[model samples]
Target: MTPEARKNAVRWSVFALVGAVITVSLLFGGVSDFHPTAVVRKVYDEVEALPDGSPILISSDFDPGSEAELKPMMDAVLEQCWRKNLRVIVMTICSPNSPELADSIVRASADAHGKVYGTDYAVFGYLAGGSAPILALGQDWHAVYKTDRGGTPCRDLPAMKGISKLTDFPLCLEISAVSTIDYWILAGNAKYGLKLGLGVTAVMATDYYQYLATRQVVGIIGGVSGASQYESMTRQDALRKARETKEAGDLASARMPTQSAIHVTIILLVVLGNILYFAGKRKEKASP
Candidate 1:
């Protein structure tokens, strides 16, 4: 066979393998009720134990670039919060692009849980100056969040009552795609002593585990795998609540199998390409 035929054969093999994996991914993507990781469970349980009407803060520190990885985490956490009837305040800290992203995600979750804006929840939009805003946060809620993302006076938002500073919130969940998590750790957790949990990209997980050792962080929701785990646990919790009135066990359809397959396919594709490149190099060296 000619060299061209060999190249075609290798390309077709890779394509076929990826197609097979995608098929399997779709077939098993909907699996549920599986066990969650310890890190993810700690986060779920901590929020689960909060009393109804307890207020907490969630800082979404990612952009659209990270939506696929972090949005699921945000959704699962918000579902659990609303399931327990917890009051929430949403914000975008690290990523300037996240205000609209945060707004959209929270809006959907609020609607799903029949939550009322301004009363049950509020969205504080983006502020410039990088992590400098963290220092300004607890000093004056009104000065920092004078208005909601929609330009409504925060005072009109019933949810803003009793929240003066960062410490006013007993817990703050930071879901991020960048080093914003580190900034929050230093400013939000270490400086103010506020309790911190995280939902970070898979790559960021390893770097932040050091904080977990010191208990500086409560727990972590690391990437899509961790997000799926938390969603499973949330599903179980929802099941025990009243079926019609309470939150349903229906977490968003699982993304685990498909996400995993896509990740694996990408790795395999890179490896196959490298192998074929080397094989071709050897063939060229051997040719007359």
Candidate 2:
């Protein structure tokens, strides 16, 4: 075949393969279920083990750009926290959009778990000054966030009582798509000896694994696949508690089938391309 025709053939093959993969994924769902990774399982186990009414801080630092990937993890974590009856304290410093997103996710999860606002959980909204705010929080949370997201005084909120600093909480969880986790590590963990866990984008996952290895981060949940694993674990926990499966739905699991299909298709294409390249090279050498 002519060079142009060969290129065209490869292009068309890729298109067909991608289309078929999408179709199958949409119709049949993801090809396989993912077992929970050790890191993800550790996060679940830590949250599960927290005593009732234990206060935990959550830093949600991503906007809509990462909602699809990080939101499910946040939701699953929130569900786990609320189910265990832990007091959740939420805050954000990455962007102005973050606080609202964090608030909505926390509220939705709180409502689902029959948790009360200002008592079981309190949102501090968006604090300014980037890492400075985190530092301030570590020093004095009441000074950093004098009021809840709704303008209610932090002193007035029952959940905020006795939570005067970052070290006051036994566990601090951060679901971040940016370098904010680094700030948390520096200010909260390194400085104040705060126990930290993280949920990060796939790209950022490797960046933070070193922290996990060093024991700075107690555990981690990385990307959508990580989220799916945590969701599965949470679902099982819910089942054991209620004696039946909960219908809260798993968004990460729903997206996995499509991701798995595309990944397999791409792998097949790579294998085919290599085989064709070798075959063409042999044919050229034989054309005496």
Candidate 3:
């Protein structure tokens, strides 16, 4: 075959293989749950140990751009918190759209677990002043957020009863996709000694490993794969809960198969491309 024809054949072949893999994986689960990483396991274990009615803060610092990757993470975490009967106080400092997104996830998870609103969970809308807001929240939550997204006073909310400051909560979870995670570490964790667990995009995962190594950050769920791992852990917990009562299992990791298929397809294409290039180079060298 001519060089042009060979290139076209290779390209079409790759497209066909990738498409098939993605379709099959999505239809029937492709990715198997591997062993949980240490950081992810720590996050799960900490949440698991929290007693019922314990208050925890979840800061979602991502916008719609990162919704696909971070939303599942948020849902899985919130579901676990609800299953443990923990009071979830969710807030956002990234975008104006974040509060609504956080609220929807929390409400859906709470409803699934038959948890009450206002009592079991509360979402304080976008807090202004960037790091300043986080600093104020750490010192005095009421000073920063007097009311929730709905305009109800924080004092009136049953979930915010004993939560006067950031340190009041045992755990602070940040589902972020930007530098907001750094802000949380510096302003909240460094100063207030707040224990933090992070759910960051894959791209930002490596940047924070040093924090985990230093014990500055308690745990991390990095990217979609990490989210899937946590989901698997949460699913096992749900199964145990199911034995006692009818409860839905975690579905946040359902997309793992698709992600895995795409990754594998890309890796195969890379190897194939490299082999073809070297083979063509050898043929040219032999001819001349």
Candidate 4:
């Protein structure tokens, strides 16, 4: 076969192997003895420890661009919250389109868990004006979020009960792919003392360790890999849905094998390409 065709065959074979790994990982959960990160476990433990009927806020501050990474985290955490019977108030502050993107996931989880709207959960939707709105949440949530996404008055919704300001909620997790977490850290955690946790894209995750160390962030779950770890802990401690497609942890863990496989494949292909190029040049020099 031509060198090009032979290389193509090898590449396709690697891809097929990756596909097999993904299938097996999805069928059975990822890498055995997958140790859950301490930070992720901390978040899971904190959520599990909350009182059955207490409220928590989840702010999804990313648009569709971050859906792959943040959606699984959101799903896993929401499932945990639902299992614990904690009230959830979800909102977004980054993109105008972020609210609807997150709402579908929330609704799906609510449906899966038999959670009711206005009672068990509420979507405050997107709040504009950047950090100002977040600061307003600190001052008076009722003032800023006068109503939920459905236009029902905030005062009328059971979800908002006992939540006068941002600090009233014991924990607020900011899931973002943007700088919105900075605003939450400043306005919500630093100023109002809202107990904060975070979920961020992989690249953005390292930036928040200082916040975690300072206790500004209760814990931080970063990217799909982090979601995979969080999923493990959730399954072991709070709830376990064995191979359940709808369960976020299972869904997230399924993606990890695929991601790791693809990454390894790319690195191998790059190395192979360089080796082939250098070998070809050596052959040419020897012959000519």
Candidate 5:
């Protein structure tokens, strides 16, 4: 090959190599036993300790753009709640994307745990008008979510049978990419006195902490790392009495694996590019 052509090839190869290394490193980091913060631990512990069959509202206040951080957190929370046999009520107050994203995650997570829809959990889906919808929930849940996402009447769902208002729920967990905490605080918690919790991105964690300190929120699980922490907390709680280490260890493990795989694949591409670059250089030097 021409010298110029060969040089261009080597440059591209180098770029590829760097990309690969970064990818792999990130992948390893994701699976690595990254420690959880005190806040995360508190969040997990509170949720885990809730009485079985306790109802909790999980609001998927996220869009496609923020799914990366929010999705994993949602998965982890759902898994823990399902394992503990919590009655989850999924809803979305802020974004239009809430219904689809929240429903997808809940259905998948529930399926994994063999949770029957309308019995084990019920999704109220996206309620209209943000705070308006939330406030309506305080007055009467059936008024807002007369039917679930599947078009089944909420009154007919076993999960919604006795639950009429927000306060009836033992806990309310809002998994939001947006800062819609105020609506719930104003409508649900302040009005009816329902216990509220938050799962927000790391960026939002700080602000939520302030809310938590004020007792506005019972707990806050912030970011993907926080989700991983919850996973660990779940495992610990599940096997607390089990003599076998494996059973206990299985708890809190991440239900999300795609992020790690993507990181690893990127790293491999980077490493290969570097190797090809060096190999091509050596070949060029050896030739006339």
Candidate 6:
């Protein structure tokens, strides 16, 4: 056979093998449950179990570039808060881009949970000056967020009616791609006594963990996996609350199969690529 034919055969064999592996993985690993899906779920569950009408402040401090790691976690936490009928105040620091992205995610999740704006949730929009605005919020949330995102008076919004300060909120959740979590720890939790739950990318998780371990922050969700874990956990918590608690068992179970399969597939790909490389080297040595 020609060299071209041999190359084609190798390529086809690899493709078929990959397809089979993926199929097997999906069939075996596709189950879902109530355990923590990611680090964010822990954060979400911390707030979800809070009393209804309890104020929760969320500082969504990421831009579109980091949305993949941030958006799902935001969705999970906001969904839980809305379901629990918690009063929410969504804001942003770092980038002007964050507020709009956060607003869209929160609103969509709230709508899914049948929450009403101006009543169940409110957006204070983006605050400027990065850490400076976050610090100011701790000092006086009302001064920082006297109005809703759309310029509506906070006094008129039932959700914001009695929320004059960040301390009034029992929980403060910060979803950050930047290091904005530090500002919350320094200002909000340390100073104003707000409970801090942080959602950050996997790379930033360690930086936040020191605070988490010290009890400076209540909980954290790290990266996409963390977000998925949190979503699964919250889903389980909700399912358990209802009569359909059986689904709760599937959360971690379902995810583990996929995660394991992914690891295996990566290993297999590396092995196959190395084999191809060495085989090519042998052919080169044997050539005329």
Off by over 4 Å in 5: 1-21, 26-30, 235-288
**Model 4 regions more than 4 Å off:** 1-33, 235-250, 273-288
lDDT computed for candidate 4: 0.83
Query: What lDDT tens digits, residue by residue, belong to model 2 across residues 1-288?
Result: 998998899799889879988887766663234689899998888887888889989999999999989998998888888778899998898898899988888888888778899899998878777679878888888887889889999999999778888889998899999999988899888888988999999899998888877899999999998998887877555434322332335467667878887988899878988998899899999999
RMSD of each: 4.7, 3.3, 3.6, 4.0, 7.7, 5.5
Report the number of clashing residue pairs per model.
Answer: 0, 1, 0, 0, 11, 13
Prediction 4 TM-score vs. true: 0.82
Residue-by-residue lDDT tens digits, candidate 4, 120-159: 9999779888789988888888888888988999999988
lDDT of each: 0.81, 0.84, 0.83, 0.83, 0.74, 0.74
Model 5 per-residue lDDT at 282: 100
Error of 4 at 36 (Å): 0.9
lDDT of 3 by residue, 1-288 (tens): 998998899789888988898788766663345468898998888888888889999998888898888887888788788778899999999988888878887788788788887998898999766789888988899988988999999999999989899999999999999899988999988988989999999999999989988888988899878887887776666434533443324444556667777998798789987998899899999995
Write down the TM-score of every candidate.
0.82, 0.87, 0.87, 0.82, 0.74, 0.74
Worst 10 residues of 5 by lDDT: 246-255
Stretches of candidate 1 exceeding 4 Å from the true structure: 1-16, 236-253, 260-288
Report the lDDT of model 4 for residue 99.
Answer: 89
Worst 10 residues of 4 by lDDT: 237-246
Stretch of 10 with least lDDT, candidate 2:
239-248
Per-residue CA lDDT of model 6 for 95-211, tens digit only, reads 877778878888877887788888888887777775677667667767777788898987899987677666777888888999777788887778777788888887998887777
